[model samples]
Target: MKNNIWLDGLRSVRRMGETAVVAAKAGIKYAIEKPSNARLMRETFEDLGSTYIKLGQFIASTPSLFPREFVEEFQGCLDQTPKLPFSYIQEVLESEFAGRDLGDIFASIDEIPLASASIAQVHAATLVTGEDVVIKVQKPGVETILYTDLNVLHWSTKLLEKAVPKVKFASLADIVEEIKTRMVREVDFIEEAKNIDDFVNYLNITHNKAATAPKVYHQYSTRRILTMQRLHGVSLTDFEVVKKFTKDPSQVLITAMNTWFGSLMMCESFHADLHAGNLMLLDDGRVGFIDFGIVGQLNPEVWTASIAFMDALQKTDFPLMAENMLKMGMTDQKIDTKILAQDLERLFTGVLSADPQQILSSNPADLNDIMMDMVGVGERHGIRFPRDFALLFKQMLYFDRFMRILAPYTDIYADQRLQMIQTMDPNILLKH
Candidate 1:
């Protein structure tokens, strides 16, 4: 759904207030120190209100757009919200169903939620038929609150655009619009059910055995109520537990990566929001991909080009890769081929040279430094990669960060993320 632009002025004032609060607290502390400050900021944001918490989450997913400290900080935003009481949950259901008795639909409901996010808290529940399921209930007044909060954000974006022309580069208004659309879709459980179905069907068609999604229940689902099968597993990011369950973490990682990669060809949209929290390790060691409310749609041309870009990036082919990106993303910009190639070459060579060993302890700051350089170059040259490319870059960076802790210095292109390609000897093909 499109964003309601009617509340533009109000939205601006609200966003300014939100930003002011964050700036006042964070700014003072940042001058003194920066350790775990982001974490503190996230806690404070959640404390302030739900809208800031939700905004923090959107920032977490779009790492390409934010500094690493903020992304890492906001990632914890979901876990900090105080859980709603059982009575509150009951009241929410009553309101949603117009005072209908919960006993009519649910035989039993667990008081403890499986996960409590900013907008909704998820609880494990069973219907009258004895089917185990998960229920995602919207927090009371979440829609109304979010609508008001989002209007403020939109207004703030508009004001920022007028106040500073540089804000246009960030696409503030469009970002607000996009965020509104995604958040609205998320509250629509029917859309999430479709996401589940699409992922399930994609897995079946690709013959992926190591990962699965929960079955979505349509009967009890509504705009605010999402009922899905209860999937049991440890999160994929839990290296210790995964080691206990499977002798090979590498094997499980391979299966998970392959399943995700195969989705590009078969799924309606790619799973755009895959953080560690959304992945699980089932009792049988298979991976569980949860929360499919947000996704990215890429044209086939861009998809093919993106795969080539990944392959090139893996091999550190900067010039050819830049050319491919232009082919996929830029059509009208008359890029001076030689200058673009040279600029890209310099940027990548520096990144590659920074960590030639791909060593276990290579500095991640080096990665950010290089990307920041690219961002600067784009600004200088009047070139900006589209949103999908930005999302893809963020995903790659997140994986890189994960690898730094899990398996430092090991080449990702050589190991966990490469099996989707069916080469008799993957090594030979990647050798190029």
Candidate 2:
């Protein structure tokens, strides 16, 4: 054990030294090229590999915490990692199921990966029992690399905070720790399997037949290997193809919103990452929720406060909204409720007054700016939102953008079919 620890320590030191050299080179290149700061940062993160790529994705998704330019620029941080050779994949699969023959588990497995991401690559396969599934195989040494990079990141954030005291307001080190926790869970396929199982149970209990998550095959799944039912469909992002799937695309948005909102109250953790890539319209017209890698949970108190906050926002009750926001956030400092309400009223009303069509046409930067402005006002008024709140808000923004393409000119807040506010109840919120 001591030898192993010593070897790991040596590896960590070597990795850190290599990372510093790469960072220095990138910095010098940025200085010479005089590229945009956002572009330079995005490229640097991408070059750093898996851990930093995942961090870039988090920044892209969480517009509430990040500046508009950085958030908008990181949107290009695609998760399509280069595919690993088939021989290496075979070695991983064989090692994972050491005593068994590949033929005993899968009748046929595709050589080409369906998709490749920073942590895993997915291949379509047929189970010996005649079920179609996807095999998500983890890349070799991902955990080691992740740990090394995250440790470096933690150290760097501390240095950054000391150098720029204003950056400390965002709690850079705390955010890095949070990311580390979530990313660690993400690499563990067992935890991801349980997440999918819980979400499936929630759907079953709610009788939500219109939406579904893939079923995990525990017999073949492990920490590094996740075998699950394969979903066949077109992504929600394929706007033109989605139109062919349903005449009223607006109904699709309504269905998705209702299902997701129900999950917030029913599931142990709600899906935190719901980019268009993660949502699909199946051939059977059911909405498919894929990728249970990252999820967010809310405590009962925060859940109650969040519901009240949403209710107030829908009703345009700024005072109640301010109260609920305070309840949902963390702050020991005393704040004047009336002043906070007035600030929220001015900020929200101006944003809401814009025509939906105009808002849809506006650049992502403009929308993110509006959200950042609200966050700025809240910060000044002693509102420090929990990470879960920011995650949920970012997801709502994603759904809003989907509405523009899937249900143009439709008011999500006012849509009766959405049942956004009316469905919240103590029973659902309190359910374990």
Candidate 3:
């Protein structure tokens, strides 16, 4: 125990030293180049590497917990990092499949990666049995670096909160904890493999043919290495490519939306990061859901209230919306339901009047504004939504972006095919 403590102390000192050097270099650059604080911090985060990049993304996505300027600025924090050498990737593969002949396992692995990101690099490969697959290889020392960086951030945030009691938000430490949990999960391929299996199982159970996720080859997968069936497709965002694949792209959107909405109730977790890249229109005329690194789950109570909230949204029933909102959030203060209902009515009225499409616009500025407005209204009513709400709303915004290209005129709420409440219960719509 004594030796372990000593080693841990030594590791902490080394990490602190490394962090200080990096920060000092960034500080010098900031001093020399007069950039906005937000921009400078973003650059510094990039310089600091993977953990910081993920944190920046968290900030960009969670507008409720961050300032507008910072959130907007961090949107530039793309996760595209320099790809590690192929030799390094091969080393990882060899270590992961130690004692096994790699040549027997993989017939061929393209040295040139299909994609590279902060946490992992994906390469197209073929199994010995001639099945085309993609290998997602985790970078070396990523988990160690993640733990080191998050520990530093967590400790610093706690210190700052105590030193400055008037800190902007009391949840800084909580935010760090949240980031750590998510980042750790992201680096675990086993967890991600299970996420894919669960989602694929949902597809099979529903007997859905329109959309699917890649099949996980669990026998060939590990915590650091994920092997899965490779899918050939064009991203849903590429309007022209998607058009070539499907004559009725709008129907494709509906199918994807319905599949996802059903997952909220039928599946253990819903895909949280369904951005343009992660969602695709396959060459086979099916919607492809990729990348199971991030997922969100809603409890039965939260989901029921959420369904009611959506029904209320469609009907414009302000009182029911307010009640559902209250059910989906938490607060210590007494909330006046009538006042909250009035606030929702006013907010929604103003939003719709400002151009109804803007309500569903996936433009970053527009989404941020809508989120801020909703969060502001909730704050006024002493209601703070759970993280699941944010995840759900962000995905809805992404779907809106797809709608603009595929089904601009379709009213998502009124569309008969949008199995919003029907997925949960057929009688739900009538009752609502």
Candidate 4:
């Protein structure tokens, strides 16, 4: 035990040193090239590997929590990682399914990966019974690297707090701890499988035929290896391809949004990451939802308040919005509702009045800037939102982007087809 602990300590130190060297080299190159700070930081995170890549992706997703510059620049932090050799993948499968022959379970697995990310690589495979599936295999030693990097990050956050006491108010350490917890859960395929199962159940119970998630094969899935039904679809970002799948892409977006909203009240947890890549237009015309690694769950109180908040926003009731925001967030002292309403009105008037064409053509960074400004206002008014709210808000922004492409002239809030608040059943809330 002692030797193992010593070895882990050595590994952490070595990893930290290696990361520092890489950062130093990148910094020197940036000094010579005079690149923007955000670009340099994104490059540095990419070079640092998995944990930082995940962090970069988080920053890219959560615009309300990050500065627009950082959020916009980190959007280039693509989740593609170099593919590991198939031999390593086979070894992991063998270890995960000990005493079982690979040929008995899978008839064939393509050597080339379908997609490779920092922590895992996915391969298209055929089961012995002839079902097509995708095998998501964890990269060798990724957990070790993740833990090392996360520890280094935790240490750095502590140092930052010590160096600057005011930074503690932001709860940097707590934030890092929360991130670590989620990242750790993400590496567990078993947990991810459970998340998908719950989501599928939610869809069934709600009679949502318009959306579907992958079906996990538990016999073939383990902690490091996830075997699931291979979805045939084009990403929502592929506008032309999506049009081929469904003639009315706007209905697709509405279905996706309604299904997602229903999951908030009905499912054990909601899909926390709904970026364009994870949402798809299936060949069957149903919206295919994939990647159940990240999910969010709100407490009953917060969930109720969030529902109220959405309703208030849609109704353009500033007072109700302020009241719901206060309910949804943390505030030690009472805030003047009148002041908050005035601020919200001032903040949203321009957004509400923006031309549809201009909004459709607007840069996502501009939208993020507006949302972050609203967050800044809330902060000044003594409201601090939970991270779960940020995750949901990010998905809403993604849905907005989809609408801009699929239905440029339509106002999502006023669209009769968008049954956002009406879809939430009071019975479902009671069950929770």
RMSD of each: 7.1, 3.6, 4.2, 3.6
As a whole number from 0 to 100, the lDDT of residue 272 in candidate 4 is 85
Considering summed lDDT, which 10 consecutive residues are worst modelled in model 1?
423-432
Using Cα atoms with residue i matched to residue i, what is each candidate's TM-score against the true structure?
0.76, 0.85, 0.88, 0.86
Tens-place lDDT per residue, model 3, 266-327, is: 77788888877788888888999999899888776776787788778768899999888878
The residue-by-residue lDDT of candidate 2 on 1-432, one tens digit each, is 697578677877877887898899788988799888888889989988888899998877666567767888987887789999878888889978989999999999999999999999999999999999999999876777889999888888888888898872367877788889999999999999999998898888777899998999999999999999999999987778999989988888788888888788677789987767788999999999999899999666776787687678768999998888878756778889899999989988977676555554323445555667777887788776676877777677667767866676787777778765435444554455
Give each model's clash number. 8, 0, 0, 0
Clashes of 3: 0
Give candidate 2's whole-model lDDT.
0.82
Candidate 1 versus truth, CA RMSD in Å, comes to 7.1
lDDT of each: 0.70, 0.82, 0.82, 0.82
lDDT of 1 by residue, 1-432 (tens): 135344454555665676677767777676677647567667667755777777777766555566567766665566346789878877777766765778988999999987776778889999888989999988876666677677767886788788898742376777788789888877777888888898897667556677899988787777888888898878766767877887766656556667776675567777877766677889977889998877876566776787777777778777777778677865467776667667777877756555433522222343345555666566556666566666556556555555544555567777745654443323322111
Runs in model 2 with CA error above 4 Å?
1-14, 30-40, 63-73, 158-170, 315-320, 336-339, 353-367, 421-432
| Candidate 1: residue 137 lDDT (0-100) | 88
Q: For model 2, where is the 10-residue window of minimal lDDT?
A: 358-367
- Model 1 reaches what TM-score against the true structure? 0.76
